[model samples]
Target: MKISAIHLYAIHLPLHVPFVVSYHSYDYMPSVIVKVETDEGIVGYGEAVADEHVTGESWEGVYQILKNTLAPVVMGKNPMEIEKLHDHMNKTIYGAPTAKAAIDIACFDIMGKKLQQPVYQLIGGRYHDEFPITHVLSIAEPEEMAVEAAAMVEQGYCSFKMKVGTNVSLDVKRIQAVRSKVGEEIAIRVDVNQGWKNSATALTALKQLQDCNLDWVEQPVVADDIDGMVEIKAKSVFPLMIDEGLKGPREMLEIIQKRAADKVNIKLMKCGGIYPAVKLAHQAELAGLECQIGSMVESSIGSAAGFHVAFSKKAITSVELTGPLKFSKDVGNLHYDVPFIRLTDKPGLGVDVNDEMMRELTVFHESVYLKEENV
Candidate 1:
C-alpha cells in the first residue's frame, strides 16, 4: 500500500541527569519523531536525535527536512521501497543523515509490520534474543565517577563506557578511579569525543592510560583526522574505535584502507538508519574489523533500531543502546534489565508507544499528506 500521510513531532525530552561529552553537554534530548501512515492503515514510528557537533544536525533542521524535503518525496510512494526512497532522498539533499534516518527507520517499521516479522528478522535474523547494554558515565569528578560506576556494577551492569575528554590528567584520574573501584572483571571503554585535540596530545594521553587496561578507546583525535588516527593507532596500547570519524560506507572503506582503527561505532543516525547501517556493518565484517552499535541518545524508537542492527550482524561485537535509560520519560517502552535488553517477537520494532506521553513531550508538530493528484 502507498503511504497516505506522515506526521512529525519535535520534542525536548529532559534527561535524568546532565550528560557531558567532550564537545557539548546535554541537559535534554531535542529530537524529532516521525509517524508514517499507509493506505492500509498500518502505522510505523521513527525517531531522529541529532547532535550538531556529531551528526551536524539540529532538531529544527531535522524537523524542517522531514516536513519540507523528505515528506514530499515519500508521501505517495510505497513505504516498502525503502532503499529506492533512500536513493531519491540522497539525490534530493546532501548530508542530512539524521533527517533521512527518521524516514528510513519509519519505512523499515512499515516493512516489518506488513510482513508480520520483527525488524531484526527482516534484516538478517536475530543472533541472540538479548544483548548486553553499556552504561555511560558522564564526565565528572574522579570520586563521583567511581561511585556511579560502582552503583551500576552493583546493579548487574558488566560493561561501562566513560566520557573523558576535558583534561588529560583529570581524565586519566577519572578512569583510574573507576577501574580501581570496579576492580578488573568489569569491562571499561573510554570515549574522548575528539576532545584530545591533536595526535600528539592523544599519543601522550594514551601512554598514560596504558596502565588503566581499557577495553578500547574511541575517537581520540578529531573526526576528519584520518592521518592522526593512523598515528595514534600505531602507538596506543588500547584498541581504537572510530565514532564521529565514520559517517557512512565511504568513510568506513577509508578507515579500513588506512588501517585507521581497530573498530567502528555505528549509529543509525550517522549512517542514515538501518538500511545503510547494515551495509556498513557488513563492510566492516569483511575487513575483519569489529563494530559497536552506538546511539544518538534517542528514545526507544531509535534505540530499537540500533538494537536490531546490532543483533543482525556478527561483526557488531558491542552494543550501546542506552538512550532509553537516560531519559526522564520516554514515548516508547524498551524492557531493560540493567545491563541487558530483551526483544519480543512483535512485528516491526516490538515497541509499545505511549500516545499520552508522546503528546506531553512534543513541543512542535506537523503532518504532511499526499495530494489527491499524486495519489
Candidate 2:
C-alpha cells in the first residue's frame, strides 16, 4: 500500500521534575510526532525528540523539515520501500537526523503492521524478553540525589546513572552519597555529559570517584576529543562509554579503531533511525565493543522505537530508555515497572498513541496529503 498522507504534531509535555544535565536544564520535553496513513487504511506512528545540544535540531526545525521536505518525498511511495525512502532523505536533507528518523520509524511501523508482526521480530527475533534499564538521577544536591537513588532502589531498580561534572568536589560527594545510600551490590554509572573541559579535569574528578565503585563513566571529556578520550580511557580505572561522540556507524568504526571507549551509546535519533542503529550495533559487536540503547528524553512513542532495538539486539549491553519515567505524560500505552519496560504483543511498535492526551499536549499540527503541492 502506498502512503496517502502524513500528519505532524508538535507536543510539549511538562516533566514531573526538571531534568538537569551538565549543559542545560529541561522543564519540559518538546517532541514531534508523525502519523503515516496508507491507502489500505493502516496507520503507523513515530516520534522525534528535539535536543539542540545532542542532535542539533529544534522542535520547529524538526516539524518544518518533516512537513515541508520529507513528507512530500514519501507521500505517494510504498512504505515497504524503506531503503529508497532512506536514500531520498539522505540525498535531500543535509543534517536533520531526527527528522529523518521520524519518517524511517513510521515506515518501519507500517511495514510491521502490513506483515502482521512485531517490529522487533521483523528486525530480528527477540534475543531477550526484557533488558534491565538504568534509572538516571538528574544533577542535584548530594543528599537529594542520594534520596532519589535510594527511593529508586526501594522501588526495585538496581541500576542507576548519576549526572555529574558540574563540580568535581560536589560530584564526588554526590557519588559517595549515592553509594552510601544504596550500599553495595547496586550498579551505579556516572555520566559527565561531555562536561569536563579536558582530560586533566576528568582525571581529577574520576580519581576521587574511584572509591565509589562506578560501573562505568559516560562521555567524560568533550565529544570531539578522540585523543582526550583515549588518554582518559588509558588512565581511567572504570570503563568508558561514548555518547555524544558517536553519530553513526562511521563514528563507531573510528572509535573502535582508536580503541577510544569500551562501550558506545546508540540513540535512534542520533544515528537517523533503527536501520543505522542496528547496523552500528552490529559493527560494535564485531569490534568487541558493547552497546547501550539510549534516548533523548522522549515520549513513549520514541522510547518504544528504541525499546524494540534494545530488545531484539544481543549487542546491547545496557539500556537507558528512561524517558517514560521522567515524563509526566506519554502518548503510548507502555508498561513500566521500576527497572523494566514491557512491550505489548500487538503488531508494529505495539504502542498506540493516546489521541486525547496528544491533543491536549499538542502545540502545533499540520497534515500533508499526496495531492497537496506545498505541505
Candidate 3:
C-alpha cells in the first residue's frame, strides 16, 4: 500500500514525580507523536523522546523535520520499502539521523501491521517468552533512592539503573548506600549521564563504583570522548556500557574496535527507532559486545513500541521499558508488566491509542507547517 498522509502531535505527559538526571531535571515529558497512514487504511503510530533539554531537538524542531523533510519523501512511497524510504529521507537532509529515525520506526510499525506479525518477528524470533526488565530509578537523596529501590525489588524487578551525574562523590556514596540496602544479589547499574568532569575524573569515580560492584557504568564521559571510553574500559573493574556514544552500527563498531565499552544500552528514541537497533545489535554481536534495550521514560505509546522491539530483538541482554511507571498514566489503554511486559498479542505494535487517556494527559499542542515548497 502506498503512504497517504502523516499526522503529527506534541503530547506532554506530566510525571507522577519529578525526574532528575545529569542534564535538565523535569516534572513532565514532552514527546512528538507521528501517525503515518496508508491508502489501504492502516495507521501506524510512533513517538519520539523530544527533549530540547536533553538533546538538541525541541517540539518546534520535530515539527519542522516531520513536515519539511520527512513528510515529502514518504508521502507516496511504499511503506514496505523501509530501506528505500530511509535512503530517500537521508538524501533530503544529509546525515540528519534523528529525523530519519522517527519516520523509520513509524514505517516499521506499518510493516508489522501489514504482515499481521509483531515487530519482534520482523527483526528476529523471540528469545524469551517473557522479558525480564529493570526499573530505572531517577536521581534523588541516597535514602529516598534506596527506599524506592527496595520497593521495586519487592515487585520482582531484580535490576536497578541508578542516575549518578548529580554529585560525583555523592553519586558514589549513593550507589554504595543502595548496594548496602539491596544486598550483593540485586544487580545495580550506574548511569552518570556524562556527568564526569573529564576522562580523569570519570576514571576516579568509576574506580569507586567498581569497588561497589556495579554491573555497568553508562555514558560516564562526554559522548565524543571515545579515547576516554577506551581508557576507562581498560582500567575499570566493572564492564562499561555505551548509551550516548552509540548512534548506530557505525558508532557501535567504533566503540567495539577501540574496546571503548563491553556492553551497549540501546534506546528507541536515541537511535531514532528499532530497525537501526536490530542492525546495531548485529554489529555488537560481531564485536562480542552485549546489548540492552532501554527507553527515555516515555508514555505507553513510546514504551509499548519499544517493548515490541525489545521482545523481537534476540540479542538484547536486558530490557528497560519503564515509562509507564514514571507517568501518572499511560497513553494507550494497554500497559505491560511484571517478569515480562506483554503487549497485547495482537498484530503489529499491539497498541490502540486510547483517545481519552491522551486527552487527559496532553498539555501541549502545535501545528506542522510547510515552510518550504516540498514540506
Candidate 4:
C-alpha cells in the first residue's frame, strides 16, 4: 500500500528520576512521534528522540525535518520500500538520522502489519524469546547509586549500566561501591558518554576500575578519536565499546579495520532505524565484534524498535533497552520483568501506543496529507 498521510507529534515525557549522562541531564524526555497512514487504511507509528550532543539533533529539529523535508520525499511512496526510501531521504538531506529513523520505523511497522508478522520476524525472526536487559543507574552519590543497584538486584536484575565520566575518582568510587553492595555476581558495565576528555584520563580511570570486573566500558574517549579508541583498547583490560562514534556501516567498518573497540552499541536513533541497524548488526557479526543495543531514554515505541533488532541478531550479546523503565509512563506497552523484557505477538511493533496519553503529552503537532502541496 502507498503512504497517504503523515502526522507528527512532539512530546515531552517526564522521567521518574533525572537521567544524567556526561554531556547532559534530563528530567524529561523529548521525542517526536510519527504516524504513517496508507491508502488501505492501515496506520503505523514510530518515535524519534534527538540528543543534540549525541545525534546532533533536537526534538524540534527532528519534528521540522520530518514534516517539511522528509515527509514529502516519502509521500505516496510504498512504505515497504524502506531501503529505497532511505536512499531518497539521504539524498534529500544529510545527518538527520533521528528524523529519518522515525519514518523508517513507521514504515517497518506498516510492513509488519501488512504481512501479519511481528517486527522481529520481518527482520530475521527472533533468536531470543527474552534476553537479559540492564538496569541503568544514573550518576549519583556512591551510596545512593549503590542503594539503587541493590534495590534492582532484589527485584531480579542481574546486570547494571552505570553512567560515569564526570569525575574519575568519583566514578571509581561509584563502581566500587556498587560492586561492593551488589557483590561479585552482578554484571556491571560503564558508559563514559564521551566524558573522558582524552585517552590518557580514560586509561587512568580504566586502570583504577580494572579490578571491578566490568562487563565492558563504553565510549571512554571522544567520538572521533579513532586513534584514541585504539590506544585505550590496547592499554585497558576492560573491553571497549564504541557508542557515539558509530552511526553507520562506514564507521563500523573503520572500527573493524582499526580494531578500535571490542564491542559496538547500536541504537536505532543513532543508526537511523531498524533497516540500517540490522545492517550494523550483520556487519558487526561478520567482523567478529559483539554488539549491544542501547537507547536514548525513549518511550516504548522507540524502545520496542530497538528490541526487535536486538532479538533478531545473535551478535547483539548485550542489551541496554531500559529507556521505558526510566520513564514514568510511555505511549506504547512494553512489559518489563526487570532483567528480561518481552513483547506481545501483535503485528508490527507488538507494543501498542496509548493515543490518549500521547495527546496529553504532545507539545507540538502537525499532519501532512497527500493532497497537500507540501508533498
Best-fitting candidate, measured by TM-score? Answer: 1
Which lDDT values do the candidates have, in the order given?
Answer: 0.91, 0.88, 0.76, 0.90
Candidate 1 on 272-330: residue-level lDDT in tens?
A: 99999999999999999999999889999999988888888888888898889999999
lDDT of 2 by residue, 1-375 (tens): 888999999999789999999999999988999999998989999888978877789899999999999998888888898778888888988878899889888988998899988888877878867877788999999999999999988888999999987978888898999999999899999999988868999999989877888899999888888889999999989999999999877788789999999999999999988887888889998999999998898788788888889888889867888888887888877667657766666788888789999999999899999785432
TM-score of each: 0.99, 0.97, 0.93, 0.98
Candidate 2 runs further than 4 Å off: 372-375
**Sliding window of 10 residues with minimal summed lDDT for model 2:** 337-346
Task: Give per-candidate clash totals.
Answer: 0, 0, 1, 0
Per-residue error for 297 in candidate 4, Å, reads 0.9
Q: Considering lDDT, where higher is better, how would the candidates rank from best to worst?
A: 1, 4, 2, 3
| Candidate 4 deviant stretches above 4 angstroms | 372-375
Residues 128-233, candidate 4, lDDT per residue (tens digit)?
Answer: 7788888899999999999999999998989999999898999999999999999998999999999997899998998888779998899988898888999998
Query: Which candidate model has the greater lDDT, 3 or 4?
Result: 4
Q: Tell me which of candidates 2 and 3 scores higher on TM-score.
A: 2
Q: Provide C-alpha RMSD values for all models, in order.
A: 0.8, 1.6, 2.8, 1.3
Cα lDDT tens digits, model 3, 52-126, are: 533467766776788777887678788888778877876787644555666777787788889998777777866
